[model samples]
Target: MITQLRVDDRLIHGQVALVWTKELNTPGIVVANDNAATNQMVQMTLKMATPTGKKLLIRSIDDAITVFNNPKASDMRLFVLTNSVTDALNIAKAVPNIEGINVANVGRFAENANESTQLSSTIMLTDSELDSLKELATLEVPVFSQVVPSNAQTPITALLKGIK
Candidate 1:
């Protein structure tokens, strides 16, 4: 069954391969990113990053959704990864059954202006990404930011509370 959906700029890396794998206990990992899916080097890197013996599938957003929905893909605990808030919103909208998204990391954006509040050293959200996150928060799905299971979850509501 599809379990956790994560929004992390670095999809499938050291922390995800080790920490999240152990935390979620999900053997199946699916990374849905257009750029990563099409890039052979990126795909190879993700495959190598996956924990030993766990299954990893990197596909475009649509195909990744199909993989999760397929009956043949059952029998596995799956964690879905996306690099952008927009992409996470799209996945959540396309597949209503997706549990929820964990906002792990958004990274700095070239377009980020002075208005963008730096949530962490790695995450800096621009207006567009923040707006998408706001919309996701309105959905029935839960939206919260936490780099790892150990860190306290910062709900989207709390972060957006004082912001215009």
Candidate 2:
């Protein structure tokens, strides 16, 4: 029952708690990141950041795919968050029914010149990561880069061209 899939390097934070939660009306958040899944401290931090009473499952990508593929999962509105475009693409490939994905925030470390169009002082991208995101668009996932609910989103293709 994934209502929305978001790729944000920040994972769960203020924007997610305040904006996306209400917009999607999701009762649970499934974070698909291998690193975050293994780190107790990161998991604890994200759990704390999530709004009280909402469920949060920090799982590996494989676990997320399994949960997402289950036909019975449609009852709960689930929000899937991934840290990278590659991870997001991987999960989408595994669960083809996911249809669309929203690029919430790429964070500061992964931003690169190719992503300049989506640039905010808070996020950075690497060239390879940008290329990976471009490839993702070819798969027809409709990559959008936006920080919050009010900001205008720039398509990944448009951002790629602006890089050079």
Candidate 3:
């Protein structure tokens, strides 16, 4: 069901509605953020960002795991987006079947340079986050960083090495 799991701070935005959705052929967009789940205003903002006719679900990380684990999820091309590496790590720990995580726009709030690898205008990194990403990689989950459809991706490992 989940064709792609991405870590993007912006969640559903222009690049997501216009580019990644079409590139991945995703019919459903799932935003897994605890904060967004409880806030009606933020939820409405996220819903407005999505393209018309596409199914959008904004839920907490736990609910996302449940939905992703369900058999019905297999029928839809799902795109899961989280705002932080910690959230991504949490989901991966809860759902071991998820094989990969794509690192997209991490935004301007990220601190701790050692935890993540800076990729572009919308990307940043910190060491603990990078370590968590490595844990996912050890489980055979490939972590990739790409801004948009046309940008080149750099593996998290390579970025880590460059940081060191």
Candidate 4:
């Protein structure tokens, strides 16, 4: 079962390696990103960053669904990580048992400035991103904005209420 579907552009970074995996008690991590799956450098980096003894798999979003829906993996505690909100949404839609989504880091790009709102120094969400998040919330899935397990979680629900 997927403990959480995390959206962090940084993918397998320090926090995810040292913090979330231990906190979630997941033995396996599935990175569902098309670009990362095809990029040798990114794949190598992710493998190196994963904690010792933990298993990490990089696959496209479609392949991730197949893994998650597999009955053989029902005993596995998998933490699904994605590079974008769209990727997380795709996984959530395909996998019925996703517990929730954690929005860790959404970096601001040059073009993103035009339609994005800065929620924090590290978080900038486009209007479309917010809409998708809102849609996820409507499905009764709690969305949290937290950089690491040590940080206090800020529910996207509360932030959206203020933004509206």
Ranking by TM-score: 4, 1, 3, 2
lDDT per residue as tens, model 3, 31-137: 99999999999999999999887899999999988988888776777889999877888887776555458877774575554454565666675666656766755
Q: How many backbone clashes does candidate 3 have?
A: 7
Model 2 clash count equals 9
Q: Which ten residues in a row have the lowest lDDT in candidate 1?
A: 107-116
Which of 2 and 3 is the better model by lDDT? Answer: 3
Q: At residue 157, what lDDT does model 4 achieve? A: 76
User: Candidate 4: where is the Cα deviation over 4 Å?
Assistant: 109-111
Decide which is better by TM-score, 3 or 4.
4
Candidate 2 C-alpha error for residue 158, in Å: 2.0
TM-score for all models, in order of appearance = 0.89, 0.83, 0.86, 0.90
Top candidate by TM-score: 4
Question: Which 10 consecutive residues of model 4 have the lowest summed lDDT?
Answer: 106-115
- For residue 144, what is the lDDT in candidate 4? 85
Between candidates 1 and 3, name the one with more favorable lDDT: 1
TM-score for model 4? 0.90
- The CA-based lDDT of model 3 is what? 0.78
Candidate scoring better on lDDT of 1 and 4: 4
Give the winner by lDDT: 3 or 4: 4
In candidate 2, residue 162 scores what lDDT? 57
